[model samples]
Target chain A: MGLIAREIEAAGLPTVSMTSAWDITEAVAPPRAVYFHAPLGHQTGPAGEPDTQRDLVARALEAGVSIEQPGEIRALDLRFPDATGWEATAYTPEAIPMSPDGKPNRGAPREPRA
Target chain B: MARPADAVPYIERTRALYARQAPYRWVVHDLEHEPPPWTPIRSSLASSRVALISSGGVHREDQEPFHFRNDVSHREIPADTPASRLRVSHFGYDIRDAARDPGCVLPLRALRELVDRRVLGAIAGPALSFMGGIYSARLVRDDLAPRLRDLVLRQQADLAYLVPA
Candidate 1:
């Protein structure tokens, strides 16, 4: 994601990214970013929370405009609900479902329902 | 800003998780010397055309799903597509929340609402979606980035908002 942001920015388009993974964002170092300590797949906000999502998106765009330094990742002053407990279990082997080969099955397609 | 108290050590956890998979090793790209590209915003949010991009594997229900691994390809989802018509496919994280409310990742609906409220001027182009778990940074820099850049250019977007899952 950071790489793509950099490429787009290089092509003369301003870009701002919202990232859940600080480590990866730090490594790739996009032109601009807003860090969310939320869990993966919930970078914008919690599911079914429209107000929170809109607020975050607005703040991210604000950061894109106000940020002066390149590669700046401004951390949002917010937390996901149940953040502590979610962090404790996220990415753990026991928490991930395993396939028949004993590998994590996180990639399998689960189509969204309307 | 101080690090969030609830921040997770995702890098270490991901490394350990990949280790358990034995043959598959996950490594974050470390670009020590490369400076980030820069383009200053020349327009106000209320007047600029903005594009939405996500690395959350979101695609319209009728579009083909991204390949689970090393899939650098992207999907161009029309900006006006209903959230209910979207789906997600990816491996790096649990996608249940995204499937339930793509606003959690893609946030296309939120973008539209912003436009309606005049917080943003307009949707510049189709929202672009792609899988972000690709192990090869080369493919992302070479294949995926250029394509997305071209699309954003074609739309003449003044700025782009990216959401990475």
Candidate 2:
């Protein structure tokens, strides 16, 4: 999503990413972003909390325009409940063959030793 | 909203949302481009047109749902669409909060309020929503990103807020 933000900004538009994924936000480095320390699914604020959510959104919109630096991330202090309650929604990939040192081998097949 | 079934690995969970899933190791991309210079906000929010965008997998009830199967597609939601008529469908994170309050993920309601309160100039039309679990940069760069660019431009949207769920 930050990648897409970059593209949109590249198109001569100003973009601000109000995102919860700081690591990825830093990785993609959009023009302007406000790191909401909430949760993955909730970026504005806690669920069913409209006033707080609106406040956060208002702050973010202000940041979108007031921000001066490129790739700037203004970290907010809004903390959500612990994520320990959330379920793992990850999707795993296929396995790869490992080498003796426990490193996965990506090279071509080698001839058998005599 | 249903409770999360297990502890969420916030780190790995977000990483999987868009990172390439290499079988051996995590592959990170150095997306460091020459960051665009600081462009000042287009006057006041009450004057410049604002665009609302989200990565929360939101769409209109009548439109086709986000293609989580492909994961690279995006959807366009009309700005006038009410929050009650909107819905979310993404697998990256627990969608319970977003389901209960789409504003939690998209902030559409807040954006609309800004308009109503005269805090914003106007709400740009055809806001965007897309599945964010895309792992391929090529898909983002060459295809999906360009489509988003086109949307912003076509709408004549002066400022855009991208709320990534």
Candidate 3:
């Protein structure tokens, strides 16, 4: 996403990226970004929370205009509700159970490789 | 920016996880340049035509789902797409929450509400979406980025809001 932002910005369109991954954002360095500590799939906030989602959308646009420096990432103070220890669980292989053959058993079915 | 004391070192963790789980190493591109590309916002949110872009694998029910691995192609989701009509197909993160409420990832409903309240001027129809966590930075830079840039340019969007889930 940050790569897309850079390309769009280079083409004369301003972009503001909202990211949950701080390390990836730092590495990719989009022109402007608003960081949220929310979980990966819930970057806009929790599901069933319209108010929080609206607030986040508004805040991201505000950051689009207010951010002055290129590659500047303004970390929003907003926190996902009751989201404790999410970082520990996110993107970790250990969370998935291992099969008898020693293969990680990702319970959910994934799309077959094309 | 001040991160929380307990912020996870995702880079290191992901690197290690990929080593254990996948056949290949996972690496994020570390840009060494001092400054990234920049384009100033020419209009206020009340007047600018904003476009939404998400790396959350969001697509309309009628559109094709993104490939599970190394797929850099994107989908164009209409701005007025309802929450129920949206779907997610990505492997990098849990999709349960997003499946229940697409707004948590795509936020088309929230963006429309903003436009209705005059917080935004208009939504550039046909918002863009693609799967993130691709292994090749070259594909993203050379293929996906250029294609998405062209689409956003065609929309004449004054600015874009990107959400990476």
Give all candidates' CA lDDT scores: 0.80, 0.67, 0.79
Local error of candidate 2 at residue A63 (angstroms): 2.2
Q: Model 2 — TM-score against the truth?
A: 0.78
Question: What local lDDT score does residue A101 receive in model 1, on the 0 to 100 scale?
Answer: 40
Candidate 3 lDDT by residue in tens digits, A7-37: 8998999999998777778777888988888
TM-score of each: 0.90, 0.78, 0.89
List the pairs of residues colliding in candidate 2. B46-B121
For all candidates, state DockQ relative to the true structure. Answer: 0.60, 0.24, 0.52
Off by over 4 Å in 2: A81-114, B1-33, B36-38
Off by over 4 Å in 1: A95-114, B20-32
lDDT of 1 by residue, B20-62 (tens): 4544433344454677878878989999899988998888899
Model 3 Cα lDDT, one tens digit per residue, B1-165: 555565567677667666644543333444454467888788889998988889988887888887656789889888877887888887677777787788988988988999999999999878789988777777887888899999999998888889888
Give per-residue CA lDDT, model 1, range A6-99, as digits (tens): 8899889999898877766777788888987887889899999999999988987887688897877788777787535777877766544333
TM-scores of chain B, in order: 0.89, 0.79, 0.90
For every model shown, the clashing-pair count is 0, 1, 0
**lDDT accuracy of residue A34 in candidate 3:** 89
Q: What TM-score does prediction 1 earn?
A: 0.90
